[model samples]
Structures are given as structure tokens and as C-alpha cells.
Target: MSEGSAVHQWLCWGALYLLAARVALSSETRRPCPQSCHCNSVLQEVNCSDGQLTTVPNSLPQNTKLLNLTHNKMKTLVHWQFQSLPQLLDLDLSDNIMALIEVEAFLGLERLITLRLARNHLKIIPVGVFAGLPELKLLDISSNEILVFLDFTFRDLTALQFFKAADNDLVFISHQAFTGLTSLQELHLDGCNLTAVPTEALTQLSGLRSLHFHQLGLATLQNYSFRQLEHLKELVITSWRWLETLSGNSLFGLNLTSLTIRHCNLRAVPYIPLHHLVYLVYLDLSFNPITDIHRNLLGELLRLQELHLVGGSLLRIEIGAFKGLAHFKLLNVSRNLLTTLEVGAFHSVDTLKTLGLDNNPLACDCRLLWAVPRRLYLDFRGNPPTCTTSDQLQGRYFLDFTESELPGLLTCRQPRILNRRPREVRVDQGHTVGVYCVAEGDPLPSVTWISPQLKPLSSIGRIRALSNGSLEVRYAQPQDSGAYLCVASNAAGNDSLPVSLHVRAFPLSSEKHFRLKGWFAFPSASPGLSGKQNIPFDVKTLMVAATIGFLSFFSSVSVCFIFMFFWSKSRGQIKHTATIAYVPRSAVSSSNGGKGNYMETSRFTMKLI
Candidate 1:
């Protein structure tokens, strides 16, 4: 054997040994699985849920695609925990006690597409923790203790399509936090402490389709809050305790399909620029305090299909309130304070399929006849609308009223005396007298008078019935001094009142003359001076007899007139006053030869002194 051949054999043997050792080490590192974890080589998956592990295992399969470490005791994520697994497509570390994530913790995960670190104790995310993940498409950090989103937090995640940070302690997000998420389609920040919409952060995600901010601390939605998000399709914002106003342009520049803003303590239907949302199909503004629906409130929303305004403080729907909503299919106005709905309120909505007006106080009179014909499209399945007015229609369903029954039910109100005629009237003889009776009813009542002559008085000689149901008596006499009845009658019923008239006579003057010759001649005149008695006597004798007769007559008449005048002057009597009786026209005309005229005239006597 030569010395050179021996040296070559030894060097070759040493090289072979080193190569075998490397192979053995590599094989050993890939064989063993983490404790209490299941590894399926065929599927390239590892599940370590509820394992009580404190950290990620060091000896994971390099080709593993799905890793789940949920419900574990892992406290922190050091840099590059899965550095050896470049083919990892999905990683879930949810429900872990992870409080910190070191910078570059996911540095080597170039092919990672989905990452979930939800329900953890992480309070902050380092700026570059998710950097270099160009292929990452979905990330969920929900239900965590993250307090703020720094600028460029997701700047490098350009290909991310779905991101959820809901139910976190996030109070602030920088304008550039979501700057590079051009492909993001859905974003959720519900159950967070945000005080305003992340408008600046959302502008970068022009392709966003759905957004959720439910259970937030936001107070108002300013104008153009969602401006430039032309491709947004659906938005949900519910249960905001302080949210009050939504500016008219808050939803501008968006092509939304569905919107929900319920339980936000809003006072009215937020003034949304409906013209801009031409493609909107469903809108929910329930649980608000809106009072009325004015005409054209939902103007020209031609494509709108469903509208929800339930559980509000609505009172009225003005005429033509829902104009230009020709395609409306479902309308919910249930559980409100609506009392009246005007005619043609829903005239423009020819395609209405479901009209929910339950649990309201509707008038249910002729005014509701507009809806009775359309009852087929109404939804009274839950607590039908009840009538709030009309005595005969009260407590009845508006749909049950028929067209003919409505008119009768509407005219059932009895005649009510809005103003009554005077109970007592005083008028001087030969003066005009008038009395008015005013009343109100569904069908205006006709008024007539029962005169002092006990007749049903119409326009006759000096008496006339005015157009306004007033009684006018021209040249009232002392005979018109009794109770007059003013009767008002209508379809419902009749009402009447009694008015007493006192006709005062003309006062006598103190300078009136007294009669002397008539007082003496009344006693001197015989009962029957049948024949003419001729007195034959001389002039002197006749003169003496005449003088004696004149003396005797003058003495008796003067004494009688003096006594009567003094008696009348001392008594203060009203001899011209007279009592009048009121009787029905039927009774008066029969007794007075069908003339119904009974006028009593007073006579005045003139005496010469």
C-alpha cells in the first residue's frame, strides 16, 4: 500500500460522515409535533387549541399552511415566531392572553393570506408588525385591547381585502392608518370607542363595499362624512347613544344598496341627499322621534323598495307626503303617534305591497276612506290601527269601515248650540225686534221660531225669518209679549231655547186733557131715548132752563174729572201693557179661520176740558 492512497481514503471517509450527520439532524427536527397538538402532514395543518401552551412551539412543520392556537396561554408574540414556515396561508391565535407583539413578528410570512389575533390582551400594534406581508388578504384583530391606530398601521397591506377591528378599545385612528388598503372590500369597527366616522382613513379604500360601526360613541355624522367612497354598497350604524344629527350630505358620493341607522336617538329622519342615492334599495330609520312626514320627503327615490320608520313619535302624514316613490314595496310606520293621514298621502306609491300602520291612533272617518280601498295592501297583522275619533267609529278598525258606512258614521254628531239666543228681550211698542241663534253640527241645522201668538212663524206681514236663522219682527206691538221658542233641527237631533219678550208701552204726558162733558152726559142719557122729544118754551124761559141745566152738568162733571185725574196720577198704573200667549201654528190657524193672524190693537181716547 502507498502513503498517498491511505490519505485520500481518510479524507473521503471524513466528508461522508459529515454529510450523514447533517441529514440525521434535519430528519429529527421535522419528525416530532408540539405537545398536546395534532399535526396532519397530509393536510399541512396544526391545531393547538386549549393546549395551555405558553408560547409557540419551535418544531413546527415548515410546509404547514393552517395553524390554530386558539384558547391558549400564550402571553406574547416574539419576532418571527413562524419564520421557518413561509407557506403558511392561515394563522389563528385567538382567545390567547397575548399582551405584546414585537416588531417584525410576522416578517417572514410572505405568503400568509389570513391572520386572526382576536380576543387577545394586545394594547398596541407596533408600526411594522404587519409589514412585508404583500400577499395578506384578511386580518382580524377584534375583541382586543388595542387603544389607538397609528398612521401607516396597515400601509403595507396593499392587498388586504377584509379587515375587522371590532369590539376594541380603539378611541382614535390616524388619517393614514388605512392608507394603502386599496383592495379592502369590507371593514368593521363595531363595539369600539370611536367618537367620529373615520372618513380620512376610509378615503383610501375606494373599493370598500361594506362598513359597520355599530355600538360606537359617535355623536353626529357631518356633511360628506363618506365622501369619495363611490363603490360602497352597504352601511350599518346602530345603537349609538349620543348620535343625533346626520347632515344632508353625509352619505354623498356613495352607491349604497342598504343602510341601517336604528336606535341612535335621532329626532327626525336624517336629511339624506336622496337624489344622490338613486340606487338605494333598503333604508331603516326606526326608533326615532320624527313628528310628521312632509310632502316629498323621500323625493324621487325611484328604486327604493323598503322603508322602515317604525317605533317613532310620528303624528301626521301630510297630503302627497310620499311623492316620487313609485316603486315603494314595503313601508313600516308602526308603533307611532299618528292620528290622521290626509288624502293622496300615498298616491304616488302605486306599487306598495306592505303598508304597516299598526298601533296608531287614527281618526278613521271619511278622511280615512282613502286607505279603505287600499286595505288589501295594508299590514295590520300586529295590533291593528284603532279609531281615535267619531263616537260610532271609535275603537273600530279602519279597514272594517265600508264606503257607505263611512259617510253615515261621519255625520252622526248631534247638533250643538255653539251660541244660544238671549233668554229675555225688551222692546218698545212699534219698534223692531231681532234675536239670533247660532249652532254647529255635522249637517248644519235649520232654525225656526215659535212666536208670541203661539204660531210657527214664517215670513209674514211684519215678521220674517232671516237667512242666518234669526227671527226679525218689524214694528213690534204690545201684543208680542210672550215666550218665543228658537228651535234648531238636524239629522242627528234638535235643540231649543225659550226667549221672553216684554213690550213696553209709550209713556203718557202730564199735559194730557181730561173729559168733563162725557162724565156728566153718561148719567143723564136715558137707556132708551127712542123718540124725539120736542121742547116748546119761550127764549127767556128756555135760556133760564138751559143755564140751570148747564150749571148742574158743569158742577157734576168737574167734580168727577177732578177725582179721576187725581186717582190716576197717584196710582202709577200701566194700563196699556198686555199679555201675549205662544201657541203652535196648528192650534192658532184652526181657531183663527186658517189665517193664523191675531193682532190686538190698543185704543186711545181724547177728552175736552
Candidate 2:
């Protein structure tokens, strides 16, 4: 065997031998109990609680495994206080007046695993007070007057797994206060004076799995509040009355499996943050002011199994509000303002096991028929749902009716036309008209209009069937003048109302005479005669015709002028002017190199015919 392998084998055997020796020594060792304490030999326990002792008791058995000295008046824990009890595994000093614990107080306790200092008057924990406890796994200092945690306060407790510091007047925690707690998994910081999360301090505990925050003065959970807590699996935040907004990315890097947020002043669900928790299994959002669940808000939570939204002001659940939740099992929405539960709100309820709908004023109607058939498979917690409305079924249990009676109990009201009397409507040709009819029913009625020509009028073109059971006809003509029928129908029954419409036609013979007079009327007609009485000619029509005739004559004259001007100019003769030039004799002599400077004058004239 190699040298390294030999040494490992030797160490394993040595650890086994040492464990056996310690057990043998503990079973054989025995000592007399102190006057103020009780000892159990078989269990190796020492209980000195409620003794009111001012100091640690002497004569403790060396093999004691559990030591409890709670409810005492011990003011200090000095060095080597538990040096004699090497095998002690648990020590509880709760309900004491201990104000100080000197360094090296637990120096020799190498195997100690649990220590509780709850309900004490301790305001400060000295550094290195828990340095030698390498195997310590749980430490609780709750219900104290501790105001702050200094840096490296718990650096030596490398194996600590759970730490509780609740119910303290803690104002601050240094960034490196929990620097060496690598194995810490659970932490509770309830009822503190912190205004925000101490993200830097908590990031040192890389293995943390659960965290709780309660009764804080925070108004908002800001973005990236728990950014780097990658292994955290459960989070609880409650009793924050001032909390209003939970930002969209507050839980950015966490993979929490369970989340609870209750007893806050939130007016709406924080859907932006919740959509990121695709692996979430349980969620509780109870006791808020939320009134409705909108569609697609919880659709991304595919693995969600239980949802609790109780004791809120919830009034409605919109259609497909729980879409994409395939594995959902339980939904508790009791004590709300919901009057009816519609089956179309959920994507699928095949996997639902328990449902809570008690304490709501649900009206017993056909809307609840879908849940009645699934009652055999669903478990209704608390009180069974009872009807508070419907004159015949009020104060009756939902499940009391038999399958045969359900058909009669869950019936819809037939559609009834509010206006049943035939009416007459007169409209001028080329004008618009509307025929009116209204309906009332359990389920709203759909309106259809049949025209005078026996054709259904759709809401597409000139003729339209309006939303409120009214028919509108645009540019009414003679063909549109007849009796029109408006039909309103639903699943229960149908109703119809007739309306007589008359479209006034123009006077054709008078119109022809008026046109002929407008074109051939003589200007010698009497000036005092009224156009409508004598001439049947309109002054506005005459002015319009005169304006058109003037514009046409002006346009023709302008075109003829432009063409004649261009033609005359093209046929005219061209003329050019003559040019004459005189050059000096000195200039000619310069051109001749000054040889002939005497009297040389030149004149030239050019012209074109």
C-alpha cells in the first residue's frame, strides 16, 4: 500500500477506537449531584433551572451530555466555566440575567453542538466568545437587548447551521458579521429595527436554505433585495403593515420553493416578481386588499401546487385566470366578496384536490352548475357552501340538491322584449332612420333585425343591427319603407317586435317642371313674384348655374388667347441691328509692329435680313 493510503487507514481506525473509549468512560463515570441541581445518570443530564443561583454550580459530572441552567441570576460567564464538562453536547442558559460572557468561556467545549442564550439581558456578545466550539450547529440569542452586531461576531462558528436572533432591538449588522458561517442553513430575524434587508451580511451564508423577516418598518421590498441567495428554498415575510410595493426583481437570484407574504397593505398582486418563480410549489398571499385575479398573472407557475388567497377583498376571478397551472392542487379563496364561481376561470381542474369557497355570498344560479358535478372529487374545507340568493334556494346547501333536481333548480330566465307594441316611424328619403327595441334576460339576449324585404340585416353596411336591439338604415329609399321585425333570443326563449317605417318619396312631376323652368325661365318675369309660388325656380340654383357658365367661358377665352398669341409670334419675321466698329491707326501700327503708324482707319457694319 502507498504511504498516503496507509495514513488514511490509520486515522479511520484511530477515530473508531477513540469513540469507543469515550462511550465506555461515560457509562462508567458517575458523580454526586450538586445541592441545587438534579442529575440523571442513565441520560447524563444536569438540570439546574429555576434555581436562582448566582454562579455556575460545582461538582458537575464529567460525562454530562445536556446541561441546562436556565432561570438563574448568573451575571457573567467566566473563562473555563464549562471546562470540566468536555462531553457536553447541549447547553441552555435561557431566562437568565447574564449581561456579559468573557472570551474563552466555552474554550474547552470541543464537542458542544447546541447553545441557547434566549430571554436574557445580554446587550453585546464579545468577539471570540464562541471561538473554540468547532462543532456547534445551533445558536439562538433571541429575546435580548442586542443593538448591533460587530464584524466577525460569529466567524469562528464554521459548522453552525441554524441561528436565531429574533425579538431584539437590532439596529445594524456589519457587513462581515457572519463571515465564517459557511454551513449555516436557517436564519430568523423577526421583530428588528432594520429599515431594509442586510444583503451584504446575509450573502456570507452561502448554504442558507430558509429565511424569515417579520414586523419590520420597511415600506417596499426593493429590486434585487435577495440577489445572491442562490440556494435559498423558503422565504417568509409577514406583519409589515407599511409594506406597499414589492418591486419586480426583488427576488432576482433566488429559487425559493415556498413563499409567504401576508398581513400587509398591498393593493395588488406582485405579478412581475412571481412570474420568475417557475419552480415554486406553494404560495400564500392572504389578508390583503386585492379584489380580483386577472388573466395570465399566474400562468407561468407551472409547478405551483397550492395557492392561498383567503380573507381578502376578492370580488371576481376573470376567465382563464389560472391558465397554464397544470399541477395545481389546492386553492383557498374563502371569506371574500365573490358572488359566483365560474368554471371558465380555471384552465383545467382535473388535478385539483381541495377547494375552499366558504364564507362567500355565492348566489345559487346556473353559473355554479359546473362545480356541482365535480363535488364528488373535490374536497371542500371548512363549512360547505350555502346559497344566499335565489328566492327558492336561499339558505339551502349547495350539495343538498339531487342530480335530478339540478336541472330544474339551475334554469335560465327567458328573454323578454321590453317594448312589445308596434310603432310607426316616418323618415324622409336620403335620410337615416333607427327602429328601437330592448331586451332583458338572465343571459343577455342577442339582437337580429329582418328588413322589410325579408332579408336579415347585418351590422356590415347601409343597414345595421345595433348592439341595443335597434336597426339603423342609412340613405333610406322607397324600398326601405315597410314593416321591420326585431328578434331577441337566448338559450331560454325568443321575443320579437315589429316596427312600421315610411320613407317619403320626392314629387317627381313637380321636380321635372321645376328643372325645365330653371333652364328656360325668361328674365322678363315679374320681380315681385315669389320663386316658390310663380316661377318654381330657386335663386341658389340659378346662381350656381351662372357661376359654372362664367367659369367655362373664361376658361375657353383664356385658351384661345394663349393659342393665337403663340401662332402669330411664330409666323412673324425676324429682325437684326447693324454693328459698326472703328480702330485707331496706332492700334493697326501696333499689329504691324509700328512699321506703318500713319493714317490707317477701319469701319465695319454687319446686319441680317
Candidate 3:
């Protein structure tokens, strides 16, 4: 052989010789227990850790209450080897290859209370494996390769307190698998292959306090999956991709304290009542496909503290959805597809503290901050959104925008429409008053108002323009009570259809005399508040007549004075000319007060002759 091969051979021989010597020494001392299983007579305990022991030793100390046979190559529990240890209280067969357990494997250990079979290759639990252990309190069968569960797997274990079957390949669990486990406090069935758990499956566990059945690779959950487990405190029945049967009323009678249902395929999370679960404080339904939200669904969960809806595809939220959740503290809706929420969506959750909505296609409106209008613990670290019109949201923190402002703070789309023009009309309620109606026409029409008596109220109303400047009308008292007809003439002089109207007198207080039943009193401009009126003037007319008489008397005197002055001037011309003085008719009239202010004077021109 080569030098390297020769050296490796020597090393292998030396190791085997040392191992044989140790086993021989242990056998010579009358201890059939393997050399790896250390023994202590004082404590009466044996620890066989990390070995290839074929079976547990039968000659162990009668006082041994604790035996740890961990990490061994034991294929099956040997009754003859372990039946003599009557005081054994803890037996740990974890990390072993005990694939097919015989029914009487644990036959003689009547004092066994705690058994650990974790990390084993157990396919199915035999009914006799736990047949005689009446006082067993905790049994851990987690991380096993269990595929099928026969009925009555735990039927006779009446005192079973804690059972753990986590991380197993359990596919089909018979209804009787947990038949008589009444005292079971906590049961874990996480990471199994359950597609749809029947409601009656958990109905048998009367004293169960908490149950976790998560990540069961489920697609559908029936209504009866959690039918009768009234004493359950915390439940995690969510995260089945096809689990969609749970509406707001699924878990009706249970008094659960905390519940989780995350990472499921529900497009909408219906509101489920939690009144019976008065002590429920923690609730998680995150990562579901929930999109619809019914109003006032969370009101009954008065004591719920934590709620998770992470990774859900929830889109729309309604008003008053969280109407009276007084004790809620933490809420998680991370990685969801929620696009919109009303401004008052969660206002009624009076004490909610923490909320998470990160990594979602948040409609990214400036108003997302409304999700936490008050000071709150929000975990929207990084979510994607695009509002190309805005500069404030350019790569900054989404909460920087949501928190800096409010929910729905994002910009909304707007549109523009045309404005309508106002119209005017003229009304004359006199004998010729008229009413008219009109529509678009090639030529103007001659519309008129008529009384029911067949007499035309006003000829002008026949051509009055409408309020829209497209019609005209006249009116009489009685015909005005009904709609007036308007005829539109076409380019060919053909009359067009008349637009119909249900017209009556404009309601006025003055028209209360025309009151009809059921209608309000006619609206009227307050009387004396809308017009200009005149008063009687006979006394003023008489005063004017008296003043005119006084003025005329003065007028006649003044005229005579002027004429006398002229005659005197003529005399001064020494009889050269005949002087004439005359009194006009107005002077006589003025003396009898015929007019206004007049002059009165005497002629005193110097006559030298």
C-alpha cells in the first residue's frame, strides 16, 4: 500500500480498538446499558445521548424516574427492555428511528407522565402506545413523519393536558384521533397538510384552552371546523390559500381570546362578531385576499387589542367599519392591495395604537395619513405609488406625506363642464297679460294666452318670448291657471310641437285666497314691502289757488306805475307828443291774486311843466 493509505489504516484500527475496550469494560461491570448511556446511582438516572443503541436497557435502576434516550438508532420501543422501570416518569425518545411502534411498547411504565417522541419517523400512533399511562400530562409528537391518523389515537388518554404535533406530515386526521383528550390545555397542529378541517374535528375538545393549526396547506375551511370548542382561548385558523367559507358569522359560539388568520386567499374580509369572545384581545387575519368591508363589524370586539391583516388584497373600505372598537391597540395591514378608505373609516377604534400598511399599492393619495389621524405606530416604511403631478412625494417617505397631512391627502382627478345662462321675462297682469312657451325653431312662433272661456286674454301673448328667450306669452286671470300653449313656426311656416308646462299663478300671500289643500301657503312679497304708492292731495291744491289771487293784484298795480312814468316823460317833452297810459288785462287779473309775486309802485317822474 501507499504510505498515505497505510497511515489511514492504522488510525482506523486504533479508534475501533478503543471503542471495543469501553464496551467490554461496561459489560464486565454487569451493566448491559451501552457505554454512551451514563449511569448515576445517587440520582438513579441514565443518560444515553447520541448513540446507536438498538433498544432501551431492561436492567435500569428501579428508582430511575428520568431517562433520556436521545439521538439514538432505536427502531422500535422494546417492551422487555423498558417494562421493568416502574418508576420512570420522563422518557425522551427524541431524534430516534422508532418508525413503527408496537401496541404494547410502553406497556409496563405505569408511572410515565411526560413522553417526548419529537423528531421521530412515526407513521401512525398505535392505540396501545399510550394505553396504560393514565397519568400522562404532556405528550410531544412534533416533527414526526406521521401521514395517517387512525381513530381513537388519543381516545383513552383522559388526563392528557398538553399535546404537540407540530411540524409533522399529517395529511388526514380521523375525527377520533383526539377522541378522549378532555384535559388537554394546549394543542398545536401547525405545518400539517390539512386542506379543509371539518368543524366537528375540534368540537370534541371540551376543555381545550388554546389551539394553533396554522400553515396547514389548506385551500378551503368549512363552517364546522371550529363549531363547538367553547373553552378555547386563542385560535389561529387562517392562512389556508383556499379557505374562504368564513363569513362574519362563522365562529359564532366560541369565546376565543386571541385569533389569527393571515396569508390566506380571501379577497374580502367580512366582519365577524366577537361578542361571545369577551376576553379576545389579540386577532390576526393578515395576508388574506379580503377586499370588501362591511360596516360596524368590529364594534362587538370591545376588548380586542391587536389585529393583523398583513398581505391582504383588500381594496375598498366603508364608513363605520370599525365603529366601536374601544380597546384595540395594534393593527397590521401590511403588504395589502387596499386602494381606498373613507376619512372616518377607523375613527371608532378609539384606542388603536399601532397600524402597519407598508409595501402595498396604497392608492398613494396624500390622504393615506388618515389611516393614523391621531398619534399612532404606523409601519408604512416603503410602499410604491406614482402621482407624477406632485413634487412633495418624490422619493420621500410615504408616511412623510401621509403623516405630514391626512388620509386621502393625495390629489384627485377633476373635470370641467359648461355653465348655463340665466333667462329673464316681463309680466303684466292687466287685461292683456300673457303666458307663452317655445322650443328651438327655424322661424318664430305666435304664442298666446287664452281663458277657458275661449276668449283670447291677450293678443300679444301669442308671440311673447319664453323664459329661455325661445318662447313668449300673455295671460288672463282664469286661463293663467293652466299652462299656455306656444306654437313655433318653421322656415316653411309649418307650426312645430309646443313644449308643455304645468303653470299656475306664482304663489303669493295675496294668492292665499286661492289656497289648495296639502300645499304650503302661497309665497308672497310681504305686503307694503315691494312698491311705491301715492297719498291724497286735495288740501295742497286749494292752497295753491289762494296764493295765485294775491299775486295778480300786485301785478296790475306795478304795470300802471310803469305806464304812468312813460306818460310823465312825454309831458316833460312840452306837449310835443301825446302820452298814453294803459292797464293790461294781466294787471287786472293780478289785482285779484291771479298769479305769483307781483310789483306795486307809483309813477313819480319829474314833469317840469
Candidate models: Cα lDDT each: 0.80, 0.86, 0.64
Off by over 4 Å in 1: 1-33, 39-44, 272-275, 339-343, 361-609
Q: In model 2, what are the clashing residue pairs, if there are any?
A: none
Report the lDDT of model 2 for residue 36.
89
Residue 551 miss distance in model 2 (angstroms): 39
lDDT of 1 by residue, 1-609 (tens): 799999999999999999999999888767577877999999999999999999998888888899999999999889877798888999999999999998888989999999999999989998888976889999999999999999888888999999999899988888888888899999998898777788888887889999988798778888888988888999988889788887778787888889888888788666455567778899998887778777776776668888888998987777677677777778788888976555467745557777777778765554555567777666655555677655667788866776777666643357676656468889998899998877776545668888767788886667777778888878876667888888887545788888888888665443343333333423433223212233223456657989999999999999999998888788785375545455666665566775556644434454422
lDDT tens digits, residue span 1-609, model 2: 999999999999999999999999766776689888999989999999998899998789998999999999999999989999999999999999989999989989999999999999989887889979999999999999999899999999999999999999999988999899999999999899997899889888789999999889899999888877999999999989998889888989989899999988888888998898988999998998889889888998889999899999998887788999988899899988887777767778788888898888877777788878888778888567788767788888877889999999977788898967768999988899877788898656678999878899888898788877788989887677888888887556788888899988755465434444455546645343223423455557878999999999999999999987787679787555576678886777676785554655677777643
Off by over 4 Å in 3: 1-33, 38-45, 58-65, 145-148, 167-176, 190-201, 215-218, 247-249, 272-279, 292-294, 338-343, 361-390, 398-609
Best by lDDT: 2
> Alpha-carbon error at 427 in model 1, in Å?
28
TM-scores of the models, in the order given: 0.58, 0.67, 0.55
**Predicted model with the maximum TM-score:** 2
lDDT of 3 by residue, 1-609 (tens): 999999999999999999999999766754454476788777767898886777776566666888999998889865444777788889899998878778777777778899999998988887766777888899999999898677888876788899999888887888777788888989988788866674555777888888888677655554446767878887876556666656545677678878877667766554544545667788777766677567777777788777777666766566677667766666666665665444566744446556565555444453444554443344333342333324545444443554345433554432211122222333434234323344342222234333334354443444344444244443423233343333433222433232333334443454223223444454434333323132223445656977897789889998989998788887664553444455566676777685655644333344333
Model 3 residue 100 distance off true place after TM-score fit, in angstroms: 2.6
Q: What's the C-alpha lDDT at position 456 in model 1?
A: 85
